[model samples]
Target: MKNKVLLLTWSALITVVLLASLSFARQGTGLIGNVFSDFNDFSWQLDEFYDIVGPTKLNSIDVEEAKKNITVSDDEIERHRYRYGTLADQLSNIHDQYAQRIADAKDAGNELLMNTLIEERDMKLADIRKNFESDAHVEAKIRKEKEKALVQYLNDVKANSFSLPVAYEFTDVETGETYSSGDVSVPAVYKKQFNAAKGYFKANSLPGHNGTNGWIRTSDYGNQAASEDIQITTSVKTFEGTVIVPKSAVAKGGVLYSQYKDFNKGRLATYVFWLLGIIALITLLTVMKFQKEWVTGTAIADWYADLKIDLKAAAFFMTALILVGYIDSKSSNLSNFFTYQSLGRWGEWLTSFLIGGVVMTTLFAFQLVNGVERWKREGVLAKDIKNSFTLQFFKALREMFLKRSIGVQSFILLIGFFLAGIGFIGGFIDGIFLMIYAFCVLFLGLPALYIFVRRSAYLNRIIVATEQMASGRLNEDIKIEGRSPLADHAKNLNNLREGVRISMTEQAKSERLKTELITNVSHDLRTPLTSIITYTDLLKDENITSEERAKYVDILDKKSQRLKTLIEDLFEVSKMASGNLELNKQRVDLTQLLQQALAEHANQISESGLDFRTTIPEEMLIAHVDGQRWWRVLDNLIVNAVKYSLPGTRVYVTLRKVGDSAEFVVKNITKFELSENVDELFERFKRADTSRHTDGSGLGLAIAQSIVDMHQGNMKIELDGDLFKVTVTVPTK
Candidate 1:
């Protein structure tokens, strides 16, 4: 508690000192103009004061006296006469002006108006001709106009000279007489102490009439009449009295003056420096203490960290705004020192700065303690931004743009929809707009209607196709046109139709296989059982020799064993079909396994009069499989090859690595034609010997296929006329 109190006290004190320094820098009169003694000066202030007071001695010109001396030359008079252009062009201009008006009036049957316009044109032309013929009359007319213009110019000059509250005393150097305007008794403080004359003057030359030629020349008459020219040269007057402004003029209403006064006379600069020095020392001590205690132990830091993410973010944003506004306000106030304006409220500015400084320091400390830690504990800045509502809205809007086809189509349709609606309404508003409605219908509405009809027809076709597929007719595929949503749906329906067709075909094949399985099982199992029964009945006939009885007993024994073998094979095959067969798997050399299978069938291969050709890689090809199950697969293929190969034909058994898998292939010419579907050879109780005369269960290939499937291996049978081939592939370790 003590540490917390001490830290807060020290921090608040630091904030106050910092804010005071900022305020001093920002306030125009506080630092640059007042506290900074080197920059403080009074000369500029005196100059500005004199400007406010304005010039004292005013000059006037006598236009009548000056005009009497203005003489117009004959050449100048001639020039002025034709100033409007040649007489012929002048008459033409007048005619051009009234010709259109006169014709329009005549066309309207207003003869009086037309005659009036013709008379005006004729009078203007007559004046132009008269000026062209007479020179003296033109010269007199030009002189009168020059006199009138000079009088107006002088009158304007006098009207524009502003009267001031200033007093002036002028003494004539020759007469020793004094002329005064106002009181002419200003004090020494407000006097404009300057060596130069400060007043308006009259000249023999006219204002802006100095040129000898061109339209800008107001008059050259003064240049010609040199003798009568009354040149009013500037005269010097000796002024004895000092000009002064009353103290009221430089009071509160005149902020610049007051500020200058404070700038010159105020002596608080040393005190301000000492205060800042002391504050700096205190800040150093405070910083040293803070380095030891930091903000982690502060209750405020804890409270800030405990705030909800949104509330904390708002606090951070508002703090930033306040700091920015405070800095901008201070910077603008500081700039005002160089400008001539009212000084800001120093006390109010200081107070606001202090408050803002405290808030800034508090939030900065809190941010140091909690902000980075919180972000690391929660999520990164990207995650936070991605979760923001504004970003999410923009992300969704970006996705809308990313789907360009849909967005473009939707945008075009929306425009067409609105345009068509507007056109429909416009048709009722005006007859001319009826064309717009028709144009929109032909260009926008008709195309949209056609697309809708086409899509609807396509949808109807899809529906019909689906109905046909439901009724088990899946031959036809729905036609897909464009990359539209409807087309995608149609594609999906096509795939579903293919899937359904395959499912139905598999169902029919399963039914036929089930019937064949029952028939084959009945024939194979009953044959052995019947032979055993017949031999047993023969042994039961006692009227026979011992040798005959023994032979009969041997026959019964052989038939019973065959029956047992058939039943065992049937149970094993059934177990494999039901997916209940378990195998002990291990890494076995497939080359060696194949060699062992072929070696076991060597006797049969030789007895069948078939040449057995074995090909295997010398290097070990290892595979992860159940040793006994894999051996069974190999044994079945070799046995079938030896049994079914045509007499004196070559049976090829090859084992080699193909990429990442081991391929064991067996090819031979079958002794019998495999006219049926080659896929049906893997069925139980089905074999190349259609007569069921071979002393073997027909479950060899079916069991082999089941075992290969369980081990995630592949077994394929290919038949070409009398040629039979089997390929078994399995992944090698």
Candidate 2:
């Protein structure tokens, strides 16, 4: 609250004071006064006075009214006194001259002459005393003298004014050479008339003398009067302002001009005041709002965080400042400075530099603070930077310069700007651009070039890696470098290479498994066929015993049955894998199916010497699937558990609803040690036992997994220690 009041008070004080100053200036006698006085003109001051006190005040200042309060200046009084004193002396001289003339007449020894001379001398002396003794008489005398001068001046003007332009000539005292009539020189008194006479010579070809004295005719005048010279004479008149008008009126003209000058200045000051008042109000309101944090945090603030200060920008700013200062320092040309007794141009430069330096330093301090704050705040929320300018610089260098593409283009464009700068600007600007070019080449160029070249090298590696992969050699890993796009591409390429290698490895494994499957099936089928063939051959032999014949027939039937089952299992597994098996999907109780399968496998479980550990939930776990296929899945899992569980080892079968899915898990300890390669057990002719000893076909788990997949269920196998666990999850909805 106090601070707010203080701000308002300060603002009010400043505004009031400035307003007062502004009013004073606008009255046209403050700032304007100083400016006018610089040129020795106080006209604006008079203007201010007249504007304040209008023509009414001027009209009020009558001569009689002015005389009542006005005192004459010393120069005027002294001049008038000298004039009065000289008149008194002139009166005394007149007296003395009259007395001398009186004495001369008296000395002629004629009574009449002496009386007449004495009378004339007395009359003239009295007249002189009367004229010189009183100011009125003196003023009248001056008026008469002016009247005489005016008349004489008019007469001279009349004499100089020719009826028509006529040639005139004058003799040259030094050279008596005949000269062109207009070319002849004259006294300053007759120069005007002489110039007027020039048109006559130029207008007419004839030279002759006119009837007027010294007026020569142009017709034959130059030829006939070649040796003749005419004399030139005239009187010239000059006048003063005081002679044509009252001293007061002439002074008033000056006053009026001054008034107008003040009016213009007042207009200018008015504009300044209006702008100042507006700015003051805005500043106050802005400050109040800013103090309240009304608009503190914004996009600009965030952008400020990304702002960075550049030394080159500062240097350019200073360079511009120096140029402006130089221009200002040279405000007065060298010639003027020297001729007008001012400071030397160098001295002016020094002074202006100091002043400009002070102003620029203040501005620079503000800018530097802002720049530093921005630089500091840029990485405030960021990592890999420790809030030091140096750290930030290096970070930027690593990210923008050393890395590649994204920032390398900026460097390229910057170089291009300078390279193209010569076309846009010439002279000093071109030179400066050249300097920038050299600077960039020396500093930024080497690093940028390295980045680009390194980027190119990475690209080449990627290309080569791609070509190798295209040619079926995809085992190589592409080297990853910077965090640039090219590096990302390299990483992707490396992943692709690994993927391709895995794919190719899988392909080779599949081929090997395919060969093994063919070989194993051939051997298994041939063993049964060979038995059948031998039995049939034995049956064909009539010499064999009856029991032997019966045994051969049973053997043939058993081998045929085994061959048919294996072929059927293979076809079912193939159909399931090829996605050709369709399901009559419906919501089925997974728990019930699991229990039923467990019950059916109970006899096998009992015979196999494997204990059953069942945890089938009664809460009715349901799954959307083919009820028959789901039963088969349970039957297969149970059968496999019964077959694979070691004697006295428990097989766990659990059915539960987890979230929206039904999970059925079967876990067992294998009777035959389960191979680590459990996935191969799902392939045809592959089993835990590499030797064809297990009676069950290897397609049991494979068909179950395929049925689960057809129902959009997940089947997972986990092997831990001597335990194998298979989990199947089917969606309920």
Candidate 3:
């Protein structure tokens, strides 16, 4: 499960990376500007051609005329300097007036006035500078200063320019007859000048009128202009057929020179080859990984099942990936093979498949070996290889596919594939680093989460079971089974449950046996003691006995009878508790039982000088219970009430049907401080009163409790101030 989860996580990570990389790779860098700038050699060549070829002719004419005209003297030089200084001062004074007017307008918050003044100032200043610089000798000096600027502008133009050989068709404005540029020929001088300018204009296809009538002149046509009405047609040509020219020859339609079609084609081929090589390497690695079988000392059948599942999953995943790639390639304009995007997608899918398969296979193998060994001693496997393979295959398939063994296996495969794909895509060192990082996070974090959840649930179940056991409800079954650690813990919990049940059962049995032994011994002793007490009483009552003899005999008879009754009660209590004595249940009247018990204790109650009262409904209160046992219950309560009641205090017995049960309650006011713990009085051999006035056994209430339990009724004792109460509730028919 851990490996499976890891595989899934790894697969997801690889998928994300694959998508991200493809997205990044598709966006070409904006480095064309930098490349153009860096190749300054191209710019310089163009600059030199324009300056030496075009501007040289104009400069020569000016220089030759200057040489024929005159020589400069000191006076002329001084005069020229004075004129230049005067023009500069006048220009500065005009700028001050403009600046003052603009500042004042801005301070007054008059934006309109400020803008107007600034525009007026700029126009006046330009007029003044132009007038000053346009002088013949001044222009000569300016031209010298503008040389570098001219070269730089020309370089910018050349470097920024590109042109395609479009199939041009020109239509005559007058005749509408189309003529191809290839078919037309004009003079070399006209062609050279026209073509240079036309080439430059066409290369830098600006979206504006280049001349009058909205028609641009070509470098091959010199100053000739075509009317806008004379439409020119053009079409795109493949790079293979497009002509390339030298930087110098490019200005005009001179012979085409430099060509890069073959070079670009070769470069593309190299790229494709390299891409295929990488893909092949990845494919080979994946195949090897898939072929490598994992050996786990688990049951062969289980391993086979797991292996079958992993393989099918892998195959399905790969098929899906391939299908998607094929569909995308067919539907889109993207290349069908060797694209960065396609490769990444394939890598991610392959990674997932390989990782899932490997992990599942490994786990399956382990489980299979284990299972096989477990069954080996039982002769589960045949020694024949053919039979083994057949068994293993079917078993493998069932476990792997039917049982969804793919869960853990898929996770493992995903993780492995993600790491491997990451490594493959990233290249050796970087890929390895990424793979390691991914593996650690997936293998560690996911498994930890699973274990945490599993253990938490397991602990919760255990706690609940423990609480039930603590509450004396030990008959609960805890059964947990799985490959998870929590499952093992659940087994332990189950064992603990059984242990607790066994201990409780044994303890209950021992208590029952002890109760039985005591009951039997006490009964045997009580019978003999009862006879002795009866004989002693009979003798004491005889008229022939002397006064001392009668008194001693009466004392002896009282003590003997007390002992006998105590013994009998103890025996009866034990018999009832241990389930050794069967009850003859019948429909007994609860009201009658209470009345009889109260009447039997009436003499004692009256002797004690306590008011005895009975409240029983006249209606028939029927309940299923042993009449003899119920009588005992009522007798014990009445006796207890009589003994505990204070002299002149009232003792009350109430019997009635309350809801679904018949309720019997005996309440009496006690002379002594009522015992703080009433439950203790229900124990065998226990007594509420230390005085021996009551010739009663403490086992009386205990026996009553046993009888009530046998009838599935509830008995309780309560004390309020000097009032002591015993209540019994039995189900009524």
Number of the predicted model whose TM-score against the real structure is largest: 1
- Residue by residue across 599-657, what tens digits does model 3's lDDT show? 77768777888777778899889999999988988887887777767888777778888
Lowest summed-lDDT stretch of 10 residues in model 2?
Answer: 237-246
Clashes of each: 1, 8, 34
Candidate 1: TM-score?
0.37
Clashing pairs in 1: 186-244
Stretches of candidate 3 exceeding 4 Å from the true structure: 1-545, 691-693
Q: Quick one: RMSD of model 3?
A: 29.7
Error of 2 at 670 (Å): 2.1
Q: TM-score for each prediction? A: 0.37, 0.36, 0.31
- TM-score winner, 1 or 3: 1
Which ranges of candidate 1 are over 4 A from the true structure? Answer: 1-484, 491-510
- Model 1 gets an lDDT of 0.68
Relative to the unseen true structure, what is the C-alpha lDDT of residue 134 in candidate 1, on a scale of 0 to 100?
A: 84
Better of 2 and 3 by TM-score: 2
- Predicted structure with the largest lDDT when compared to the true one: 1
